[model samples]
Target: MVNVAKAQDETTAAEANTGVAIFAGGCFWCVESDFDHVEGVRETVSGYIGGKSDNPTYKTHTANGDREAVRIVYDPSVVSYDALLRAFFRTVDPTDDGGQFCDRGHSYTTAVYALNEAQAALAEAAKADAAKVLDQPIATEVVSAPTFWPAEEYHQDFHAKNPIRYRYYRNGCGRDKQVEALWGDQARDGIGKK
Candidate 1:
């Protein structure tokens, strides 16, 4: 009953010829940073989804119950949806039962928010492929995207806007190390392998 196609169209200006992928992978800061590095991705916005409230704020989502998510706008001509899918599985613990490393909560879970039927199938296929690669069972959810409420302007590009602080926080939090440990060879080699 979830209309991902409609959500996708609303999130992305399809007439402008752009495709969007909404993903919830732990911290939005990390998620936005990851996609920012990927080629063909135009922009990544931190946000909240899969909640009961409208226009939810970070405080409301984190303090209460809501999924922390990111909205990614990209040119499909340059990067296929499959490629993004690969990156998603590689960057986060797909088998961690909704919660990502260091950040445990419904708000910090890993999820693939499908914008359409095609995206839903693609997400499932990607997860299946990842399951074959890893020993653990995949736990990443492939669900219809919820109403996205953009986070505060300060949270938009926290990494870029505050490089030193961001680096310090990231390093101190041990995110990179955990990601490497979980990903292992996949992290070193990149997430291109299917």
Candidate 2:
């Protein structure tokens, strides 16, 4: 007979080896959608971070200084954090300090919440490289990771749940076109094969 409990334990152990990276690149829905397509990305959760309030909701987080962010669970062995950083910078306009694309607000600003010293260093280096490549100062900030409050269940995988609305919003926002113009062929390349 199969040892179900042992199998479950093995699965848990395997998942324990994964790493987490959090980022705020404008709307959580769009950020979540973009990371979901990346290889080695196990999962992406839409959430709010860098806030003082406890249990922040979408309606209150922006006012509370929380930014719309995504928690990415990925296999480090398969995809390096550096690669993820490259993909992230390519997906959003790092030069925009006010916000991303059409979204203009504190909550929609781009950020990289580094979970550790190493990640922070990598983020800084990535920011510098991105600025050099674009020949413009990058506005994205690399800050320490904070308590991430997951957004409501309705916000999770929103792109998949509401394809039409997601398409409309994405196209209307001109996210892809802007990214393409910014990063050229490198745009969305982070979603490359595992």
Candidate 3:
């Protein structure tokens, strides 16, 4: 069995120096791409989580109730979790339980997978703040993090590796349009702007 604490520490190379956050925000590709633009984010891995099956793959994960997710490794000294939360809120339509944008499925639902009690509280606070801003109840779930199974290698850094395709997909999906409409001037606030 893997020692989760040790695995998390090793994942970032410096246990005390690096911080990790997991987000199931619609499509993992877009979420990974967005967080990659954040200032303190050291790395982002596309993955699947909150599933009944342990070894669910790309094709079958959704059937197991897994949602596409991203695991972000960041430096708290550079970006606070609160900032990450705020950034997260701006990136997606938190009120949409039916899925995000053109993506319509349970796997496309948004969630903040809090790795600890602190994160859980922060997520809830962020959701409330977002709700206040949008004047709507947030549908995003804040739950304790479960095992994050990384997606196939081809899914990693998809935006970087396949920029043209990624751009086409993003545009066709109307993700930016929707986020801009929902968050207005603050859409993607903490990404490259950070």
Sort by TM-score, best first: what order? 3, 2, 1
Better of 2 and 3 by lDDT: 3
Residue-level error in angstroms, candidate 2, position 3: 44
lDDT of each: 0.80, 0.85, 0.87
lDDT of 1 by residue, 1-194 (tens): 34655554544453376788988988898888888887788888898888877878877886656788888888889988888988888888888884777778789888888888888889989889989988778888888876787899999999899888888877886777876898787762333221
Off by over 4 Å in 3: 1-16
Candidate 1 vs candidate 2: the lDDT winner is: 2
- lDDT of residue 115 for candidate 2: 72
Q: What is the C-alpha lDDT profile of model 3 across 36-105, one tens digit per residue?
A: 9999899899999888989779999979999999989899999999999999989999999989999988
Q: How many clashing residue pairs appear in each of the predictions shown?
A: 1, 0, 0
lDDT-based ranking? 3, 2, 1
Off by over 4 Å in 1: 1-8, 11-15, 188-194
Query: Which digits, one per residue and each the tens of the lDDT, describe model 2 over residues 65-153?
Result: 99999988889988888999999998899999999999998899999888777777888999999999899999998887767889999
How good is model 1 by TM-score? Answer: 0.89
Error of 3 at 118 (Å): 0.5
